[model samples]
Target: MKVINLFALLFLLGCVVSCSQPESGITNESIAIIPLPDSYELKPGTFYITGQSSIGIDTSDAEMAALANYFNEKISDATGFSLPVGNSGTIVFQLGDYKELGEEGYRLSVLADKLVLNAYKHHGIFNGIQSVLQLLPAEIKSKEIQAHTTWSINCVEITDTPQFAWRGLMLDVSRHFFTKQEVKRFIDQMAEYKYNVFHWHLTDDQGWRLEVKSLPRLTSVGAWRAARVGNWWEREPQLPTDSLSYGGYYTAEDIREIVEYAQQRYVTIVPEIDIPGHSMAALSAYPEISCTGGPFQVNVGNTFYTKTENSLCAGNERTFEMLDSVFTEVTRLFPSPYIHIGGDECYKGFWEKCPKCKMRMQKEHLKNTEELQSYFVKRVADMIRKKGKQVIGWDEILEGGLAPEAIVMSWRGVKGGIEAAKQGHSVIMTPTDHCYLDFYQGDPIVEPNTYSMLRLQGCYKYQLVPDSVDASLIMGGQGNLWTESVPHYRQVEYMVWPRALAISETLWSDAQSRNWKFFVHRVEQQFRRFDLSGVNYARSIYDPIILPHLDKENRLKIELQTEVEGLNLFYTFDNTIPDVYSNTYTDTLTVPKNASMLRVAAYKGQKQAGRLIDITIEDLKKRAMEPKK
Candidate 1:
């Protein structure tokens, strides 16, 4: 691809355009940047990138040169200029030892003539580059070279750094496989919001999505599963007649490619092998490692607990050997200092019944199955530690006894996180209520089918560091996107965004600096950018919050509210689609005697801001009778 020069192209425009005033009601506060930066001062003149603009970096330093090239390629798409790293360019990336700004901190000075980004390390420079991109128009994200785009950046003095080091997002690929390209896109989005950790949930009971050379059947058998798609945990069970042909795994080459790609963005790839429990797929491949694991098929999302086994038998020596083989390959494949060993929801029922488990318990002087689970985790932790990688797992690993040198990823709630932090272990506080992106962020009636609700408001308001615990022990938090309900890449974008943005902000920005109203406004601005980039995002929070309540007269009444203010909720009892011209909801509604259904929608100005939602009177009655959330 030929690199376009920015200077010649801008010179063709005949004059330098350097308007510093906020154009068309756009202000500093309205900038749609996710994970908002700490401090910035808007200047009088704008920095219009011209063909003469070049990225200045220490060409002798390979890493700095690479970082400059990354920014060069990004701007080249829109600016029509493949900026080179020379002695001194208008855009400069200077690396130095500025300890006060921290390793991931940067100070940027943008003027009409030049933009200089100074940082203490490579990551800081990279972060400054992202802020610059955000300051520009959204067209910079276009894959194709845009012909008529004005690549103008706001002139400003800015200093920013992350509040937490472990800003991350986890994707569970076992439930629904995503291609390598899709995974790369996911990582790119994470890096956009300054998330540094890519937690790859590689193995689960439903399927295994990683390859181990020594364990051939792990992918050949465990990675493939019978196809079943519906609401997760409600799909049909895999029968003997079912053929396992609807799954895929990442090859060693694919893993390397993704790791290298993530490295370019300063993102770490943390591979997770959910073990002991969620290992039915593995047992399906090697049944001897399980107690009663003969003829176990990869789960088809059907309910299974009493009939089949998922946990690896703690008593089996082959289990450790197989794990060693798996982790040896995993450690070699990923350069991350940490590996996730999922120990959540392990069923110990089979352990109580199996003779081998009892014998192993006696040999180790274990008190109960909980201790047995702990022993399994400790052994796995040791295995991972020997490979020079620390082990991080779900908070369930804290049961009976905490493993040595292990980090706890608290998913159940803050209770487990507090427990882990008090014990002097580093903790990642990703409580389910705040950080589970897979859950429904809107009403199920209007949103895609998914269980539970973790609203964008709830996520944005999450207090990550508990006051009672040692704040230093808190290694920061991340959002987990379990792929149970998310089946494809497009839907993945729909489920993650807006909410993931909330998580990113919570993890990156300080609690005191965050304001809910301001963040929502910024999110609305981001939605416009997403629209420009053709990225899917949920606007369901703007939809009316339909609630069924009983009046004093024992009649079912409907109440509606919206997460966003200024949205006009219009409703109709006659079941016609509601629009702005329809009856406005000023008060609670009484369901008409013969009305079959009620439809509601929210509007801003003349445009439909939220999706239309229909609720049958019968469903409303049923909801009224149910317990309040």
Candidate 2:
């Protein structure tokens, strides 16, 4: 074995200290084959980076100066190209011409020791910077301290690009409010992870978070609400006394600014205007839309209100007129090609009891409640398509027969996507089991216990393609962060990162290029990045679980070895977080009532490590955690 230098190794160790690792070394080849170091010597010159003319810079923009200063610092730290006042360095990067290079836009080439990073857009440049950051040492990327003079390049040539057209993260701003700066910070994180789509859930039952100039009440009355009492489904009903209160929405200007910023990072902001269901916020603003026209108030404190009979307002030309106007403003605000018309869990009990709905069903010769949902969805889809946009909805949109030219977001599972795909419709696979970011990764007790079934490893191991199906039907995948309990920016970041990073690589990196070991290394590196950026990610306790190897007879066992202190193992074959004091290690764990998936978590004092096991257990305790469910 080669004897490594002590101080350098110690420094590197410090860099990776807090990011505890699996004692067993990484076995993946991609991670095992890092280029050996040749030399660390300093000799460089001037470097220049430019953007497309649309950016309009002439060495006068302060941000340009800042960008230059940042690169200057990086060069000094990594390649020892320190210059005094007027020394023009040997390296120069001319950045410009921002445009989408299809899917293969990311490219970097070193010609005669001069590194050139090129993309059609500034966002491409940002992605290039992220790749370069990965190439450097963890210490260098973290910049614990910038190097004075010591840099060398050994002829590196790289042409990088994303595999999927859409690598996205959806943040539901309706249940929670994030400040403008906070939204930008999330964008920064997205860019860091090479994510290119930001699915902004702008409205829901809890709040209408976007400002509509035509209707001030969208922000004034609809946006405000009384403090929530408890779980939305189980809160005690307070009397319908007059109490108006709480929260704010994004003004149109605020949204424009946000969109522009995200555009700079090459992230398309797709606004989700929940409809059919999750429309209480909108209904509250316009009582005329409700079947019951009088005294309809926002359902504050999680009280589920009966749907008003005025749902589609059949024959009420006025209702269609209102929707036309509403969507007009919506389309103007969000330029994305596809708009989300939330069509899940509508609880059409009100429709079942409404006279207008009954009459419409009779006149239209519709069969049942599902048909009404289909009718409502199809009309909205028709309306949106007329406005030069396509409509996307939850898998439920597939229930009443899908709308023509509609994209199916398969949240329920791969079945919906598979059905839609076979029909030749585009499908975004966000199966709640593997793509919902809100679900606890491990034992329910350890995580917030989001009703989702996806774990980190499960997410990493998921294949977007359905078995024996055409790959062309797949549009990509998204990890959704639905905020029922999460209320702040810190909580948002905590729930998104690390796990989302895993999804990022799974989506962006080449499938053959993937190595779990390299991914873990990069994850540890990201922890350092998060620390420097002041992001509130979860502790190391909730790591990806490594299953014990099984022998020929299917017997499983492995030595429980770790150097960390105060560690404890608590597991449940059934999905639940194990209590530290509860010494419950049994052969079988029963699936708790109403539970759909099994999970477990490990923890030490104040440090919790849990991951949702992607194992489907019919008998509660007899299933093994598998790579895929």
Candidate 3:
């Protein structure tokens, strides 16, 4: 009886020791922070938040105090617990002498007794606070107070910093306007991921979305366009009898509010006033500024209105004067040092036909319409410089000759970015192949109809700085969300997330730190947070991509692939919806001679995991014969 009791006691003690130890296998993911920290060390134990827990910040700094209050409010809103702000608390934020941490870097230590954040600047502290928030339970993201939720963080030490200074996301509001509240929500989500730049594409052919006080017509007339239905690219042109109103714009007050909101979140708003090209909306309001003198209407369709002469007239002095007035107001409204004057795809055909343009080109000794475009861009750059701001334009600004001080936003591809960097100009890499969030991320049949494909893995594998260019000239990278087909804010969220998450990690974490499998796991964790916050995100990573290729005998073959593992891909050649019991895909499939169509689906265990993909034999043949994009 004595021996039996001793053995039982030893077994109980062993169970206690095992329970106290940290979860087996320590990794950066043990903390589960997205855009994983530069370095981290997980320790045994957890930091518990009790009713008496408080937040401490440097009381001497006004900004720090404000940030502390902001975090306190967030915590209170989340857990229904009021965390008082004082000089001493369980959680402490202190300014440190760690100059090596840089302006946006922080050191976070989550001890069993207390949580401490150390940084040299307010930006770093803000980031450190974000890390702390991420460490909390996913229930903390809920807007409503979570009841009986355990607010605890695993003890860990993290030293974090962004790999690139410019981690950005561009939102094209011209295509589909989002309200001020929605914009704020978008910024709030971005801030959680440590994104620092918000490139606001404020103008496009579809509509002009920013208000210029001196140019009232820009918002009143340019902001609205005829409403269209169905596919954006297939929509009919606006007729005179059509109701020419289906959009909105931000007033000066609205702009000021949004700017303040973004500033509070440490996001710089870079406003893009697309020029020369994509000026149909602006020209509709002020027709005299275009090369073709006519009454123009803001485009409602997604198709490029190139034939309509949307380019601003370089020869017209009124064009310059109007631009100057617009820029004057824009510069005052936005505090960002760089203004994007879009110089992309400007159809110079009208310039070639215009007598005034020809005469101006002759007087300026310009060789071609491209040179004329360069002349216009240089002049615009000069105007921006006068306002103590720099100018950034699409890669087309490099045509003929780039403006001496203009920055290049390379959207076409990395070639454009490399060329700009070689010419001693700063470049922001946003090639469509990787950074365009509007592209279909999953199988086209399973995802919203978009022009191209950009897998999440492709985005995570992006290299911002090519080997040929100097790293200093590369300002960083951004993901562009062109909302041509996205009509609602929910759809925008679906398109932006997951892929945007990949871009965030790519821009913040070191390249060598990337592991697609591990990143997918982190994304799954974030998905829970999104669910709690009621944010829309896509789970198309499980969808299989059907790759059509020709065999050695010229027979068409279909290859199935998925970015994530453990998903069972099932297919049928008879065009029937696949189920768990369907034929499982183990290797490349040969096109059956009598097969008219193919249908594929993904499943996890007994449940359907992704959308059904349907493809015809003719479609496969056409895809196989098509030239490589």
Model 3 clashing residue pairs (backbone)? none
Instruction: List model 3 lDDT by residue over 274-311, tens digit each.
Output: 99889999989999887778688898884655568788
Model 1 whole-model lDDT (C-alpha atoms): 0.83
What candidate 3 gets wrong by more than 4 Å, as runs, is 1-29, 138-147, 302-304
Task: Assess each prediction's global lDDT (C-alpha) against the native.
Answer: 0.83, 0.61, 0.83
Clashing pairs in 1: 4-81, 6-50, 6-51, 7-50, 7-51, 7-52
Candidate 1 lDDT over 1-629, as tens digits, reads: 32112211211111111222222233345355667777666778778777767877788889998888777766554566677678689999998878888878899899988999999999999888777766775344343545556567667787888889999999999998999988988888788778999999999988889999999999999999888877777888887888888999999999999999999889999999998899988999999999986778888888898668889999989899999999999999999999999999999999899889999999999999999999999999998898999999999999989999899999988999999999999999999899999888887887777767888999999998898899999989999999888888888889888899899999988787677776787787677566655567888788778888888888998889999878899999887888878999999898878999999989988999888888889899988988876
Write down the TM-score of every candidate. Answer: 0.94, 0.74, 0.93
Q: Over all chains combined, what TM-score does candidate 2 have? A: 0.74
For candidate 3, the 10 contiguous residues with the lowest summed lDDT are 9-18
What TM-score should be assigned to candidate 1?
0.94
lDDT, residue 197, model 3: 95
* Sort order, lDDT high to low: 1, 3, 2
Candidate 2 Cα misplacement greater than 4 A, ranges = 1-104, 110-112, 119-123, 138-155, 229-232, 238-244, 301-316, 540-629
